[model samples]
Target: MSDKFTLDKRLAAESVFAAALPLCDVRLMREQRWFWLLLVPRVKGAAEIFDLSAAQRAQSMEEINFAAKGLQRAAPCDKINIGALGNIVRQLHIHIIARIKGDAGWPGPVWGRGARQDLPPAGQAARLTAIQAALAAGVGGDMGPKLSNLLP
Candidate 1:
């Protein structure tokens, strides 16, 4: 329900997956080392979550909770970390990441903690397919689009 807000100017340049809800936009992280959904409330002209009214804030939290549930079902992760770091994107987005103990960069924070291993073409395709299936079934809809499919 952020119908009154406007889209940010920088949104045009970001890597988008799909619009998951009325006020929620889901996008895949550029690096495919793991599955991470960047969910941002589509509030135009707002630099941060604090800029939203109380109602929008509550709604965003609800959407984020639902998105987290969706991610947990799709990823089947041991631990999930949710964060909204605006240092880089500055778009007031929240990241929900599925993590396992033995995953790449284990026992360490994913941000600037270790090098990311790029997913191979076949592996990436398979992972993406699995994630899509899980999201479709678990989340009751597709997590997002396959932006990688157009990279040929």
Candidate 2:
């Protein structure tokens, strides 16, 4: 495994890094209309989850679920949306979004609905702290022994 992992610039500009999981980096999207998180695997040249080995694939799923739980705990919503579309960024990243009934993009996808609004400094700090705490608390446990040996 490569120790040096580079994140795409568009991703970095869109979200804030919240925490480092066993196989991915947990990033919080800047849009305040919805609570969203991105799990970007720390693997080189990975544009999709299939690019990862079987073991890594399992680990990435676990990480994605973990981020979803964390986001749910931080913000309650009617539904949770998870996706991994690399059409623009071309990076292996999973998006976990908390959706509500009357949200800006309700009854539809959040992508390309409108421009994302930036969170204020205080709100950003609060969200970062909450997400960090949820991750540290292990919102969702590891993917068990079968996949244990896969992650370092």
Candidate 3:
């Protein structure tokens, strides 16, 4: 297994690069239907959460929570769905999606529900800015020292 961390090709192609947190490299899903964020850990060959060390697990949870709150602030959604189903992309990454009552994949999983509505360049820029700002503000609370310095 490689020790150096590299992003999965599918993920890199499907999402827009965002900021890198202390433990994860944040990516914004290109689909505009839902405000989605992917938290991909920097650990090499980590296919599951258990693949991480105890410190890493704790940091991942904190980063997940931080990302969810930042998404909520940026998108103002009724529900925020979080999951780590590595069925297709066997990388240790968590999905944070903001959902409303009647979104495109409403009442169902966003995965393979319909064609992804790719965000226009302008829309992508706006969303990225909002998300970055919200994250930099540390929406919910203190994100701890490890993460606090990486934002913005």
Candidate 2: list runs displaced more than 4 Å. Answer: 1-3, 142-152
Clashes of 3: 0
Residue range with the least summed lDDT across 10 consecutive positions in model 1:
143-152
Q: lDDT for model 2, on a 0 to 1 scale?
A: 0.82
The clash count for each model shown is 1, 0, 0
lDDT per residue for candidate 2 within 1-152, as digits (tens), equals: 65678999999998997877778887888888887888999998999788999999988877788778878888888999999999989988998999999999999999888887887778877888877766666677743332333322
Tens digits of per-residue lDDT for model 1, 16-126: 454355466766554566777777787766668898889988877876776677678877888888888778667688888888898776877688856655555665465
TM-score of structure candidate 3:
0.92
Consecutive 10-residue window with the lowest summed lDDT within model 2: 143-152
Which candidate, 1 or 3, has the higher TM-score?
3
Per-candidate TM-score against the hidden true structure: 0.71, 0.88, 0.92
TM-score of 2: 0.88
What lDDT would each prediction earn against the true structure? 0.65, 0.82, 0.88
All candidates: CA RMSD (Å): 5.9, 4.4, 1.9
